[model samples]
Target: MIVIKTMEEIMKMKQAGEILAACHKEIAKMIKPGISTMEIDKFAEKFMLDHGATPEQKGYHGYPFATCASVNDVICHGFPSKEMILKDGDIVTVDMVVNLNGWLADSAWSYGVGQVAPQTQKLLDVTKESMYKGIEKAVIGNRIGDISNAIQVYAEAEGFSVVRDFIGHGIGSEMHEEPQVPHYGPAGRGTRLKEGMVLTIEPMLNIGKYHAKVDPDGWTARTVDGSLSAQYEHTLAITADGPFLITKQT
Candidate 1:
């Protein structure tokens, strides 16, 4: 069943969202060349803990990282490792979730390490723009597919493919909830969004085909054609007014 958050619950989730945004800010400052993904992960965990929140991704379904540091062709769920170091021209996506007082907020951002190729920068720009396109449809009365189609249309028009294997989801007390939000669809289909509903509209756009392959570690997902992938996400709340980005400090 889809869960509609109470006013008080939404407030709590917003607090968690603030902490998550702060965590991402700190991680962004540390994303330059030479730093290991594990180093980023460690600092992220500490940042959340020190802020009186918990890293929701740690120990989630046996996953063992505070942040998913996906690099280059790796789509999502890239386990942060000491062996994985940032370098010039590399793009990394840092996905994180924070739990504060039992409420959860999730968000992700893709960063370019040092000086990235012009093409790679374009991929990042389109991916982030697609996310906002989806967000624009997250208002009450709009179907989930509206948001999905918005993302798909904008991304594909820019010559990128949307990932089909994974998508966004409802987020509240738990990290993943009901009403899975896909990135490509026919608008006006799927669940009709309503006020009090909270969602994560994350679109993962690949520079090549949408096909992906799982790594031997069974966590990191990479593009089948070895093309760069980028993603951007925001946790939002549907209100009578419109979509409110809980993860962004307004």
Candidate 2:
């Protein structure tokens, strides 16, 4: 069933979102050469705890980490590993979640480890702008597909393919909720968005094919074509006036 959040619930989720975004900023700052992804995960755990919010992904559905550290070809759910070290010119994505006061906020961002190729930076910029474009479409009087369409058009313009295997979802008291939010679809299709509906509209764009294959670990998702991918996410609410990006102070 689709759930509609009350204003109070939205407020609580906004707090959760702020903490989650803060985690993303800190994680972005830590993505340098020589740092282990596991170490980044540890810092995320403590950071959320210090902010009085729980790291929602640590034990979520057996996810096993505070954040998902997807590096390079790993599309998503790339486990943080000490054996894997960040080197110059690597692309890494960090997915974050914080549950505070009975609500969950989720966000993700991809960044360059050091000086990267111009084309790689283009991928990052396009992916991030696509995320915002998707969020801008998350308004009342629209269906979920409107947001999906915006992301698809924007990504395709940049010559990136949107991943089809995994889609975004409703987020509230639980990490994953109802009403799947896809990143590629026709506008005016799917469920109609209404005020108070909160969701995570994440677009995973690949530099090559959109197909993905999961690792044997059953969590890590990687590009089937082995091309670099980028992703960005925001937990948003459909407001009476407009869309509310719940994962930041603004």
Candidate 3:
């Protein structure tokens, strides 16, 4: 069933979202050449704990890590490993979530390590904008497809393909809720959105084909064509006024 959050619940989630945002901001600042992704994950875990929130992804469904550090061709759910080192000109994405007093907030962002390639930066720019384009359509009374289509149209026009295997989801007390928010579909289809419904709108765009193959670890997803990909996400609530990004700072 679709979970509708009360204003009180929304406020609690907003607090969690702020902590998640702060975690992402610190992670982004720490992204540079020579750092290991595992180090980043450790820092995030401590940061969340220090602020009274728990790192929700650690041990989630047997997954081992606080943050998913996907680098280059890795689309999402890339395991953070001490062996995985960041180098100059590499683009890495850090996806994370924080649970504060039973409320949850999730978000992801791709960062450039050192100076990246020009085309790679374009891919990142387009992917981030595509997420915002989708968010712009997440208003009350609109179908979820409206948000999906907005992302697809802009990404495709920019010469990128939206990853279909992994889509966004509704987030509340539990991490994943009802009404899967896809990133590609027709504008008029899918469930009609309503106020108080909180969901995540994450668009994963690839510089090449959308086909993704999972790694042997069964978590990390990589582009089949070995092309670079970018992703951005925001947990949002459908308000009477419009869509409010819960993960954004006030």
In candidate 3, which residue pairs get closer than 3 Å at backbone N, Cα or C atoms, i.e. clash?
Answer: none
Candidate rank order under lDDT: 3, 1, 2
Query: What digit string (tens of lDDT, one per residue) describes model 3 on residues 1-250?
Result: 9999998999899999999998888887899999999999999999999999998999899988899999999999999989999999998999998999999999999999999999999999999999999999999889999999999999999999999999999999999998999999999999999999999999999999999999999999999999999999999999998988889944
* Residues 123-157 of candidate 1: C-alpha lDDT, one tens digit per residue: 99999999999999998889999999999999999
**Local distance difference test scores for all models:** 0.93, 0.90, 0.94
Best by lDDT: 3
For model 1, the stretches where C-alpha displacement exceeds 4 angstroms are: none
Cα lDDT of model 3 overall? Answer: 0.94
Encode model 2's per-residue lDDT on 1-250: one tens digit a residue: 8789999999999988888887777777788999999999899999999989888788877888998999999999999999889999899998888888778999988989989988889999999999889988888888889999999999998899999998999988988888999999899899998888899989999999999999999999999989999998888888998888898633
| Candidate 1 lDDT | 0.93
Model 2 TM-score (2 dp): 0.97
Instruction: List where candidate 2 sits over 4 angstroms from the true fold.
Output: none
Runs in model 3 with CA error above 4 Å?
none
Candidate 3 backbone clash number? 0
Q: How should the candidates be ordered by TM-score, best one leading?
A: 3, 1, 2
The lowest-lDDT stretch of 10 consecutive residues in candidate 1 is: 241-250
